[model samples]
Target: MAYTGEVEVGGPPDVHELTDLIITKAAVGPMDNNAYVLRCRATDEQLLIDAAAEPHTLLEVIGADGIGAVVTTHRHRDHWQALAEVVAATGARTYAGRLDAPALPVPTDVPVDDGDTISFGRIRLTARHLVGHTPGSIVLVYDDPHGHPHVFTGDCLFPGGVGNTHDDPAAFTSLLTGVTAKLFDVLPDESWVYPGHGRDTTLGDERPHLAEWRERGW
Candidate 1:
């Protein structure tokens, strides 16, 4: 409801109805990476997405009993710097792409693949592999009770920019192609996109911009 200063925490009405999916920003300025805490209301099953730099605050919001799993978006430390700390506090299982497994300090409980569905109570998180910034990058899709989908697009799709280029130029091309075909093409216009950085946008808003963006290149 009310945000004080350095910290802000609240769950909207719909969020509470399905799961305690709270979005928190880490930086003081524009480039803040977004992290989420999803807690199932009925079963109290909790999962975290990206740890960022504020694990202590993230822990305070989700607490101990609720968290069961954590799914990292990529291998970038900024998106997952405090993962080990939070995992230690909550004893939650960690899931990441197999390519990112070696970089993580803890062993991954689940190596996510494209099209894999992770369920908790009424919520279902579907993994869509989009490898541009990282070979194993993924965007998660969760459908609300009303059937409206919310995409947690890590570094893949930002408000106005896609993710940065990888070591291999082919990887970047593949990433953009996958996102355009798998994400932009398939998802409905009304679907919400919660990117890793900046504010939220919709498929409707992004669709028109895609042609121009593609011409200019990532």
Candidate 2:
């Protein structure tokens, strides 16, 4: 309900908040990776997802209130470019999918497994491990007060199509299958999708495109 001035770093982010979650999103690094700061309104505790580039600016956005933990979306370089610095500065607990844990610059404090639950404030996020994007690609989900769910899907799903499989058909199939079943089939049309890069979209906007994404074999 309360709006504040933009937390400008790369540029002013498109902010979104409903009920307990306040999302501060910004583009960072060479890839223009999206890094998000998710704050729990009641507890004032934060969980940072994909601590991409621009360490100083990311820390500046964090400001006085420190983060509770830093969750790496995947082992990709662009995603965690600033993970070490941000975690070192905030001393926030670091989490990565167990399979991708060893590849990170900083050792993961918590190696999350599929279906694992991450506790923060009064709610918990369920990790849906969707492989092929990486052996450990994950999407975090929890219900919002408005009835729609808020999903942080790293590079697995995007606006128009699924993430690049680097021409690997098997990976493309695996990721697409996982996304279709675990996300689209389960969540409501109103579910908000905050991806690892680019703009945000809702399930309602993307559901109709699934068949198209599949037909093209992207």
Candidate 3:
């Protein structure tokens, strides 16, 4: 991949520390949406998470050398507008949630729903069905070859916020209760959270904010 700007910026978290798990954030599109690249250094395997915008920027970071697959978080344009462009670049297959199939550009080769795992070399990513922002929204969890477990949350949950509400009030409520009961209830407090935008955070930092989020009816 070729990037016009530095792939690593801000230097808040040492890139070397995350060497085993190569994660690069690219600001794609005019909305400045983030498209992430997750690579297993041990195997040089890569997965592009959320091909929403900025195909060139994302490609630059992942490079043209190695890309195993591309995973979409939801159906929103900010989450998948550049998917077709990405697939064309690396010949990588994409995985989308079943409910998001209708919004995908090419539905023929896409994988639907959850409980499916995409593995590259020694890295295995388990897809969890996390519906909130969309009925098909999912969270990808994996244990890097180096032994740290990380979760790619998409837009489901953010550092100081949650995904926006859906049209139906009942659906929004379900999204909240479902995730809080299923995902957040079981994951470790220290688990790392990589949202679709902004900075990375730990579950510990977000736990307290859940109450306020729920109170605000988000």
Clashes of each: 0, 0, 6
Candidate achieving higher TM-score, 2 or 3 = 2
lDDT of each: 0.73, 0.85, 0.72
Best-fitting candidate, measured by TM-score? 2
TM-score of each: 0.85, 0.94, 0.85
Residue pairs that clash (backbone atoms under 3 angstroms), model 2: none
Distance from true location, Cα of 195 in model 3, Å? 0.8
Best model per lDDT: 2
lDDT of predicted model 3: 0.72
Structure candidate 1, residue pairs in collision = none
Write candidate 1's Cα lDDT for 64-183 as tens digits: 565788899888877787788988888888888777767877788999889998876556799998877887888899867565678889889876757887445676677778888988
Pairs that collide in candidate 3 are: 1-59, 1-60, 1-63, 1-64, 2-60, 98-113
Lowest lDDT 10-residue stretch of candidate 3: 5-14
lDDT of 3 by residue, 105-197 (tens): 866256656678877656777887877678888888875555556788888877776777765666667777766775678777777777777
The true-versus-predicted C-alpha distance at residue 41 of model 2, in Å, is 0.9
